[model samples]
Target: MENMLQNINSLGLETSLTLDDIPNIDLYMDQVIQLFENNFNDSKRNQEDKILTKTMINNYAKGKLIFPIQNKKYSREHLILMSLIYQLKGALSINDIKVTLSDINQKIINDEIDLDSFYTSYLQLTGQNVIDLKKDMEERVKDVKKEISEAKEEDSGNLEQVLMISSLVHMSNLYRRVAEKLVDELVVDKEGKRQK
Candidate 1:
């Protein structure tokens, strides 16, 4: 009876690995970096892009802005999360977001939470209202610069403030989108897609 049971288990394992049964997996680390590099070249060198530099990336990776999978390589979901984290460089500070993400990941690993629900909660917790804050600030900066140009005020200080605020607003928008998108991509189950 024991040998029969063992044979059945082995058969089950083999069946699970069939091409049709393979899991809907996420993208790997290399793929994620490639995505970043591609975007970096295509985009203009704005304040948003500057924050995605080597120093910031290293800080985020070391700070646990991203979670590491053991034994197995990272999936597309992980890459998406990293990219999202990269976008968030302006708000919440590096350490703050990292700690929040780590706590969330722990809940996931412990099975105390499901990804979809977790994603929803995270979105609520982060507060999407701040995305508008960025947009408003950027618009204000633009308006100010337009006024300055009309007045022909060539004071470098005012010009600098306008540029700085624009950069901040852009970075804020970038980060908000990153966190939101990462959650959206990671939380859905493959079975959910079958219904669609």
Candidate 2:
């Protein structure tokens, strides 16, 4: 065991010590659980609730959402993304969310469309309506499928498709509500004009 540890270390594996390997496994595990639970509750909600449902967590593990960590532990960014998805709980289906996200990620491929900047812009354009958001979304969907097809031909995971998909999904959810509201407003305006 000691030789194996040494060999792993020599290879720069940096073997981690689990609670079981430590002197007080139970106590350590309890502390870890408590800390994780506290963080999970206390962390600020992003634009959306970000608190993931059990199904969401499972889907995340299944590549529906991607994070560097394979375990349940999630980063702040993941939390924010999850919250955004929470906002779209009723408005969009998981499949639609996946499509929208892929589009947003495709937009990010070039420096011209920085997601962070786009998010800020999305928020700033607060009063603007999203009547066309759906149409735009559909177009984006077509584009993403095209991108996926191109990538498939290349036989590549050059960007880790899951990560890109998850990240984009987060962005789409964040702005979806605003888009919905905008669409509603447009409908009302059109109706009013028709009545006039």
Candidate 3:
């Protein structure tokens, strides 16, 4: 169990492209697809899973989750927006993502924030959170191991299963709370008042 935990901890680190990594020149659809594929290839769960697809890109554009293409080409801003959408989609509903990104998109359009600045800040914030989460996971593992050790012999077999389920439920609840807070911050009431 210790060896397994160590191996899991040593798994490849999650990575994101920096602002400098995105091409300055506008990219055609195929180029955009290829870029996303290259970056997100590791995220695929199976051979049948696609990191990004043309249909998904088109759907994002259609759903206003990303900026509309200009002259059949995507700008750096588009790539950044798409990347944000990709990351959030796994944890958020489409409508939630749309609301959050639409707010950001408006800010970009109004020149309130440049894509470079926004993406940089996002990377910094999330990178820090990732570090914190790793520490939290380590602590949780230790706590679970201790709990399992203290369980009655007859109950020992089920302790690990209980811990796994409890951990997943806790994590899901945490995600829900964060998502709700984000929605509260981004979405306005019907009378045009900010909920937060």
Global lDDT for candidate 2?
0.45
Q: What is the TM-score (0 to 1) of candidate 2? A: 0.32
Model 1 earns a TM-score of 0.44
Candidate 3 on 41-69: residue-level lDDT in tens?
65566656786788998999899998667
Report the alpha-carbon TM-score of model 3 versus the true structure. Answer: 0.85
Estimated TM-score per prediction? 0.44, 0.32, 0.85
- Residues 1-196, candidate 2: write the lDDT tens digits: 1132343224322222222222322232233334334444433234345444455555853655433332445533333344345444447656555444543434433434554454445434421323344344455555655676776755435443453456558877777768666656655665787799
Instruction: Identify the runs in model 3 with alpha carbons over 4 angstroms from their true place.
Output: 1-13, 153-162, 189-196
Per-residue lDDT of 35-146 in model 1, one digit per residue for the tens?
5565544333443444244555456657777666644455433444554465454455665566447655665557575555444454454344444544455576566666
Candidate 1 vs candidate 2: the lDDT winner is 1
Candidate lDDT scores, in order, read 0.51, 0.45, 0.77
RMSD, each candidate, Å? 19.5, 21.2, 2.9
Q: Could you tell me the lDDT of residue 24 within candidate 2? A: 29
Order by lDDT, highest first? 3, 1, 2
Instruction: State in Å the error of residue 98, model 1.
Output: 1.9
Which residue pairs in candidate 2 collide?
A: 50-82, 50-83, 101-168, 101-169, 130-182
